[model samples]
Target: MYAVFKRELFSLLNSLMAYITIGIFLLAAGLLLWFFPDTSILDYGYAELTGFFSLAPFLFMFLIPAICMRSFAEERREGTYILLATRPLTSWQIIGAKYFACLVLVVFSLVPTLIYGYTISKLAMPAGNVDTGAIIGSYIGLLLLGAAFTAIGIFASSITKNQVIAFAVAVFLCFIMYNGFDAMAKMALLTGLQDLFMFLSVNEHYQSISRGVLDTRDAVYFLTLVFFFLLLTHFTIGGRKW
Candidate 1:
């Protein structure tokens, strides 16, 4: 498993995929939080990063797909899927390795954002009385959402051999998971299912965690979403052989 994981990770770094993904993420962060003066998190009266956290999910909608697009799709497109399938590794091992590699890529991009936190601290009136609680909570929420998006992207990639198609499908699915449910909830047609839709929506849990409140329900919801997509990816790969 470690060998497969390292191989996937090295492949990403060698191809500069990691660098490109990180660059895009940083660019989005800078544009949304730095260039926009009106709604930037820094402009808020409180030390909380409400604006930044709220904005990060939408940016991640595209960023996570870029990171996971080529994970399985590139292998399949190059006819390496057969080679991998014939190896001693199980399907789970291959999927797990790629999943883990994508996760590391997400974390790699996120680490640099800590600087924003540090800068916000110093800029705060009391030399670091910033709401570290909320900041930490928001970061946790980001990680969970990233994980869910990565899983969805991986599943989408597994269904197609073309990287571009995989990317497009992944982005569409990511957008749905991130915001589609909430939008559907607002529609008059689904008024009766409003509670169910809102509960199933990713934003509800994301918002709760971002407020520095780590509710167990939110954690469970994220875990369930991640597992559901992962299970779907596994089945998708398995079905291809039959």
Candidate 2:
């Protein structure tokens, strides 16, 4: 797992995909947070990172899919996925290593955005008057959400050899997972089951954690989402010929 993780992390960097992915994320985020007039944090008149947390999930929805689209799909397209079976690594390890590699990139991409938090802190009237707890909680929530998305992306990649198809499927699935359940909860018929639907929703749990409560249920929900998809990826890969 470590070997695969290191190889993937560096290989993407060597190919400049890592730089491009991180750059795009930062650029889009920076524009909205700093440059764009309507979305600028400076105009918000408050020391808060709310705009970032709110906008990031949507950005990551597409960004992460693009990042993982080539994980297995590229190997499969080039007829290299078959060669992976000869390695001693278990299917789960392979899936996990690659998943973590992608997750690391997601985390790495967020590092540059820390500047937003710093800027917000300084912009506060009292200087450092921001809600430290809330910011920390939101960052944690984002990381968890990103992890789930990474798993879904890798699973989508595993199912198809075409990178475009993988990206589309991953984005679709991430959208549904993130918001479909909450949308369902609004129906009068599902009102009684609203609790269940909210529980299933990535957005619902994310909002809960965003409040700085650090609820275990929300964390568990994200973990469950990640594990479920990784399991599916394991099966999908195992089904392929050795």
Candidate 3:
């Protein structure tokens, strides 16, 4: 797992993909937080990091899929996946390693935003009245959400050898997972099942955590989502040779 993890991390950095993705994230963060006239964080006249976190995750919805699209799809296209498949690593380990590599990249790209938070803290009128706890909580939620997206993306990539189709499927699935349940909640037919739909939706739980309310239910939902898709990825790979 460690070897596969290292190889993935190294390969991502060795290509322009990592740099390009990071650049896109930073640019989106900047544009939304600074350049936008009305909703810009700089114009909000507050020291809170709310603007950054709110915008980051939505941007991540698209960005993360692009990052993971090539994970297995590239290997399949290049016919290098067989090499890794024959290794001693189990299917779960391979998928987990890829998931970890993608998670690391997501976390690494987010490191720069700490400075944005720090800047806000220093600029606060009282010199540090920022809700540090809420900010930290939001960051944790973001990490979990990113992890969930990466797992979904890896599963999508594994299902097909074409990166383009993998990317499309990943983006569509991520969008649905992120907000599909909430949308379903509004359906007249499912009116009585609102709670069930919300419970199944990622955005509902994610929003709860983003507000600094650490609910066990929300954590369990994300963990379950990650686990289910991961198991599916394992099955997809396992059934390939069967």
lDDT top scorer: 2
- Write model 3 residue lDDT over 71-102, tens digit each, in one string: 98999889998899889988889999999998
Provide the clash count, candidate 1: 0
Q: What tens-digit string does per-residue lDDT give for candidate 1 at 1-242?
A: 78889998988888776687779888878778867878776566666567778888888888888888898889878888898788899888988999989988888888988888898888788879888899999999999999999999899899998888888999998888778888888884766788778888898899999989999999999989988998999999988862
lDDT of 1 at 221: 93
Q: Positional deviation of 62 in candidate 1, in angstroms?
A: 1.2
Query: How many steric clashes between backbone atoms does each model show?
Result: 0, 0, 0
Which candidate do you rate higher for lDDT, 1 or 2? 2
| Pairs of residues at least 3 apart in sequence or in different chains that clash in candidate 2 | none
Q: Which residue pairs in candidate 3 have backbone atoms (N, alpha carbon, C) closer than 3 angstroms, thus clashing?
A: none
Off by over 4 Å in 3: none
How many steric clashes does model 2 contain? 0
Please report, as a residue range, the 10-residue window in candidate 3 with the lowest summed lDDT: 187-196
TM match of model 1 to true structure:
0.94
lDDT at residue 165 of model 1 (Cα atoms): 89
Worst 10 residues of 2 by lDDT: 10-19
